[model samples]
Target: MAGGARASSSSARREVAFRRATEADAYELARRMFLSGERVDMQALATELGISRATLHRWVQTREALLDRVLGDLADEYFTRARRAATGAPDDVIVAVAEGVARATIASGAISGFVRREPELALRLMLRDDASVRRVLVGRLRGVLQDVLPDEAEGLEGFAAATVQLGLLLVWPTLVAGDEPSGERVAEICRALLAGARAGELSGGR
Candidate 1:
């Protein structure tokens, strides 16, 4: 009986894994469609997944919500690559990582295509204060700052938020006016802000 119970438990675990994979497959499918510049239609996704629209809705809530998750995942990937490739002192490393991410984002065909195809929707989704993409980007930067400047815990959140805002502002002209986005410019501004923040911190938060 004990052996049988163990077998049943293993089977149950397998079933759970399968269910999780199904859910992940939904997300992966949606992400792929987005990357391919396809509009993520719930009915189409459900038909492709062989699931009901109700199930898709239950899994991702809404189309905008799913897009938010997809954008967040993409932003996280950019941050990961930037952080991995960064070198130098903590401040310089931070600046480098920001520049790398900004450069990659500006150069991404998928992102640029999405912005060009649906300029208003793309801008609104990305620039909104409550956007998941913005949150993920800011959170990633905050984690890096916390890791590199543990003693500046009191100010890291604000610093990260401000830095991301600055990057967005720089990228705005590219999306709106068809101007070029400069990652080097972002790095320069980030470096200056970091220096100023550190100076203020050292001066007792003045």
Candidate 2:
């Protein structure tokens, strides 16, 4: 009986060791799964890591939290690239960056596929306040706009929020019904909005 108890204890130790998961490890796996157009199944993730669902939960909170991290990482990547690729005056730079983001997102097969596969989840996670991805996106755009138009930074949040909402509306049709990805349409719409914002700023907040 003592020997059996020892063996069980040893097995428990091994399981505990095997189930230890770091936040970075969980995020890397989740992000890769997202980029590959695979469903981010928490059970499968835990299984792949040889860990229990409870362990994954401890490492990354909940499934929604893990997804929020993965989506935020993906958006950051695209937004960074867009900012780097942009060049021009304040208005032009904002427009260029916005256009870059629109094109990159619209062209991503994985994002499109994920949206098509899980429309309801996408809408909730993206448009709702429960997820941080949309807020992170809007915050980043607001930061860029503020940088470009420092004098108008006081009221830029509302404009940035509206821009995010409008962009999502434009892309919803494509995501829901497999409509063609129209980068030009997004660019024009954003161009008009940004230009109008600039013009408003110049015209005493009209």
Off by over 4 Å in 2: 1-20, 198-206
**Model 2 Cα lDDT, one tens digit per residue, 1-206:** 33453455344434445656566666776766676667888998777667788988999888877877777777788889999988888777777777787788888776787788888877777777545666777888888977888887665546666666677777755677778656677677777776666566322211
Residue pairs in clash, model 1: none
Provide the overall lDDT of each model, using Cα atoms, as 2-decimal numbers: 0.76, 0.71
Q: Provide the lowest-lDDT 10-residue window in model 1.
A: 197-206
Query: RMSD in Å for candidate 2, one decimal?
Result: 9.7
- What is the C-alpha lDDT profile of model 1 across 1-206, one tens digit per residue? 33453455345434444454366777877777676666778898777677789998998898888888888898899999999999888888899988998998897766776777777777777778887778888888878888877887565445677777779778854766677799999999888878777666322211
